[model samples]
Target: MDAVVIGAGPNGLVAANALADAGWDVLVLEAQDTIGGAVRSAEVIAPGYVTDLFSAFYPLAAASPVIRDLHLEEHGLVWRHAPSVVGHAFPDGRAAVLHRTVEDTAAGLDADHPGDGDAWVELHRQWTAVRGPLLDALFTPFPPVRAMLSVLRTQRAAGLLDLTRLGLTPVRRLGSENFGGDGGPALLAGNAMHSDLPPDGAGSGFFGWLLCMLGQDVGFPVPEGGAGVLADSLRRRAEARGAQFRTSSPVTSVTVRGGRAVGVEIAGGGSVRARRAVVADVVAPALYGDLLPRDSLPAGLLRDLDRFEWDGGTIKVNWALDAPVPWRAPGLAGAGTVHLGVDNDGLLEAAKDIALGRVPEHPFLLFGQMTTADPSRSPAGTESAWAYTHVPSGLEWQPDALARHVDRMRTSVEEVAPGFADHLVGEHVQSPALLEEWDANLVGGAINGGTSGLHQQLVLRPTPGLGRPETPIEGLFLASASAHPGGGVHGACGWNAARAALATQRTGRRLRRALVGTAWERVLRDPRSPR
Candidate 1:
């Protein structure tokens, strides 16, 4: 094969598709019998209900350039959105809703904070100016000169500095500064918690703003039937392009010959030789620390790998409800995704609990209403709902303790819907240990691949100076969330890795280098540049 992608997760599958589209022979190896690592959906909860077992809502998928370019819709990928994208429903029956258009969303915010409507519109205006290029800069490789230029075309250097501040701003500050109350900030904080980052952390604001804006622009749409449909579409596209997939074929190691990745060794028996590239859709620690031999790695790189920290754990619960959640805040019933029973203080308190290794009694919950978005997820008059929250890692998992946590989580939901428990037909829990066991890629249940804090981001992602996907070893690249642009359902990491791998062939690398180098030189010559 021209390329051997080790792991048939979204990133790996997308990378294989990209390679095959470019007319390369690609082979994708999967550890499990299925594809879609954490993106999988199952009827694990009850009959007639298809719940997203891992990742349910996909704002990133809706906004992804690669997913758009791939045209998965033609390949049977349909996105379903609720009337409202996201809602933050507090205990007091006050809700902050994010609608499809900025105007509608702003008007919703105005109810709590007067003129906060204008603030939201202004934020969206700023997002419009640089949204395209900002996403390009984020997903593309480091030193993305073209992306930088695209943003500069719309925004001045000062505006760029402001954008940088959005990334550096704490999530709490971002919400408070832009609006008058906790409604807006709660919405942002809830979304930011999708990462391992705390609301107070730097760069958490970027996640908050990005998700909030994306939710407004394109509601957090899910596939019609289930999340698996999206994965199946990706697989079908790849297969049509002549990519081959091997399920239950766990790769033991990358066959390195003379410091270059040659292929992969299968766990039980054979080997798949890659004529060109070996894309590891696995996490960074597993790639550098676990797979490669000691001598194959440099001391400095190993030390950095040792310092690599995994994100907090997660406990997910899925339910088959006889009816839509009877939210105390009636507005929440219309939203596709609802964050139940919490405000900013509650969010911060949850984060603090996770930090302190104490399970929160009233855990802040990220609620998803599957049937609200897609009726196909359940039978008529029924709903498929799920909620998940982050927990501290390294705690010993006992079945009883996990059960207790699940009970608390259930109580958190009941706090919102008041007698929501009476509507449940069936329920299933996925603890951190169970999540890790389900998919090895979800190491320690750090779903975004790792903690996406400021320190772990940029070139320091995975390790310092290693976020570009290209590794020190020839033919080997990080093509997963462990690479740049940390997490979410977006396939940017895979696309970027595939592009880098393609660059390794022909004079593509040289051409790209020349283009970037020219841009760098021009920027260096600019007196007003921040370089």
Candidate 2:
């Protein structure tokens, strides 16, 4: 094979497809019996109710430039949207709904609070102006020259400064600074909380704004049949381009004859040699800690791995509901994704409790009404609903403790939806342990690869000086969610890695030297970065 990809997740498959398109012989090795790491769907609870066992909604997937270029729709992946993208339910009688269009979303807010509509529109307009360039910068490999030029071309000093501030400020502060009412802020906070990030966490504002705006621009869409259909589409595209897939073949280690990665040694005394490159789409720890030979890693790299931070653990509860959740606010029923907030202070408190290693008394919940987006998810009028909440990653997880957290989550939901508990015909609970058991990449249930916080992002991602995939080993590259532009079903990570590998094919040692120099300047030069 010209190249071997370990793990058949979205990023892995994407890289494989791209490599095949570039005329390379690509082979994808998946650990599970099936493909689709987090993108798989199954009838976990009931026969008729199809549940996305892991990742359900994909606003990022729609916005990805690579995915758009691949044209998955032509490959049988049909994206279904909800009438409204997001609904933030509060203790008040009403809820804040973010509809498909900014005007409609703002109008949904305008009816309850005067001028809040205008506030929402103005922010969205600002988002609209830089959105194209910002998304380009976000999705592309860093030192994103084209994306930065796009940003510079679109805006002058003030708007660029605003983008800077948005990147720097916390979600709570950004909301407070912009809106007078809780609706807009709650929406931002809820979206930001989609990761394990606290409402006040740095870089959270970007997540909130990006998701909320993207939801308005491209509704929080799901595949018509199932999320697995998405994986199938990517697979079909890759296979059509001549990519081979090897299922249930786990890579035990990267075979290193010299300093360069020659190929991968599979579990059960087997091996697949990559004639060109080895692209790993697993987590950083699995790539560095378990797969690669320890002697192959630098002492400094080992130390950095030791201090590597992971995102908080998550608890998801999937329900086979008798009918759509009858939200007290009524408006929430139409939204595919609903967030149960405790207002600004309440949200902060929930984050605080998780940070403090205590199960929250009032957990902030992210709800998904699958049938709203795709009716085929369940029988006739019934719904397949799921909600997820986070906990401190270090918290010792046990069955009894998991049960208590589940109760807390249920209570949080019941408080807003009134008789929400009554709608549950069957239930499926996945704790952090169970999530990891399903897919090793889900490490400690840190869904977004790792923390979505700024410290672990950009040039500092995965590890300082190693963000763009090319490792010290000549033919080795890291393309996992742990890489730059961490997690989500977006294929940026693997694409970046594959592109880097392709660069090596073009420039060989010269490109490696250039990449090393680039990494030194971008990473090692930082005074705050530990050597």
CA lDDT for candidate 2 = 0.87
Q: Which candidate tops lDDT?
A: 2
User: On a 0 to 100 scale, what is the lDDT of residue 274 in model 2?
Assistant: 94
Stretches of candidate 2 off by over 4 Å are 517-531
> Which residue pairs come into collision in candidate 1?
none
Cα lDDT tens digits, model 2, 232-321, are: 999999999999999999899999876778899888999889999999999998898999888776666767778788998888999998
lDDT of 1 at 121: 88
Model 1 lDDT, residue 413, Cα: 84
Worst 10 residues of 2 by lDDT: 522-531
Candidate 1 regions with alpha-carbon error over 4 angstroms: 508-531
lDDT against the true structure, per candidate, is 0.85, 0.87
RMSD of every prediction: 5.0, 2.4
Clashing pairs in 2: none
Candidate 2 all-Cα RMSD: 2.4
